[model samples]
Target: MSLYDEVGGAAAIDAAVDGFYGKVLADPLLSPLFASMDMTAMRRKQKMFFAAVFKGEANGADGYMRSAHKRLVDDGLIGDAHFDAVALHLQATLEDLSVPGHLVRQIMTAAAGLRNAVLNR
Candidate 1:
């Protein structure tokens, strides 16, 4: 099974995204970056992006992630600290959902692999 399927597919991913972003938006460090944005759309996009990533779908194309996050990098609003916080939120979300430990690690690894691109490093 794909990582997506192993993690319970779209519904699971969607739920995680919701929970993860709730934490993110509540975080002082991350909240400012999203203060002016439409969270509903952001959540939708994140769901699509992560679903694509775990499913190995073309929609998760490298350029999309890079481009999508480019403005944040350019504005100096995103860096290792922000990325780490996001990662933590994701980890916590998965854990809270009771995902298998090994699978959570795998998912986190995949997320970490994208840090450079996401941070525009």
Candidate 2:
């Protein structure tokens, strides 16, 4: 099964996104970056993005994420430290939701792979 299916698909991704964002927004370093944004839309896009990534449907679409995050990178709002914090939040969210450890690692690895694009490095 695809990683998405293994992790319970859309519902699981949605829950993880919500849980993950809760921690992110509560974080001092990360919260400011999103202060002026539309969280509802951001959440929706995150769900879709995670769904695509886990399902392996993001082939050749690395630029999509990079472009989406270009503004944050240009503004110096995102960096390696911010990425690490986000990854930690994701790990915690998956664990909190009882997702398997191995699956969490896979998800994290996939996310890490996008770090360069996310940071525009």
Candidate 3:
């Protein structure tokens, strides 16, 4: 089964994106970065993006990730710490939702693969 399906598809993606952002926005280290963002739109985009990623439908995702976060990278607002924090939030969200451990590991592995591009490396 696709990771998306394994994780409960759209409804789960929606919950995860919301839950993840809630953690991020509440985090002192991450909140400032998201302060001016349009969270509604951001959440929508994230839902779509994560859905695509989990479904293994992300073509050209690395380039897209690079472009998407280039501004943050240029500003030096994002780095290993920020990436790690986001990953932790995702891991927590999956765990909170009771997704199986093996599936969570698979998803995290996929997310980790995008780290360089996300950092615009």
Per-model C-alpha lDDT, please? 0.89, 0.90, 0.93
Best by lDDT: 3
Model 3 RMSD to the real structure?
Answer: 0.8
lDDT tens per residue, model 3, 23-56: 9999899999988999999999999999988888
Determine which window of 10 residues in candidate 3 has minimal summed lDDT.
48-57
Error of 3 at 10 (Å): 0.6
Candidate 2's residue-wise lDDT over 4-51, tens digit each? 999999999999999999999999999998999999999999998888
Which pairs of residues clash in candidate 3, taking residues 3 or more apart in a chain or in different chains? none
Q: lDDT score of model 3?
A: 0.93
Worst 10 residues of 2 by lDDT: 59-68
Better of 1 and 3 by lDDT: 3
RMSD (Å) of each candidate, 1 decimal: 1.3, 1.0, 0.8
Model 1 has how many clashing residue pairs? 0
Clash pairs detected, candidate 2: none
TM-score on alpha carbons, each prediction: 0.93, 0.95, 0.97
What's the true lDDT of residue 64 in model 3? 93
Q: Rank the models by lDDT, top first.
A: 3, 2, 1
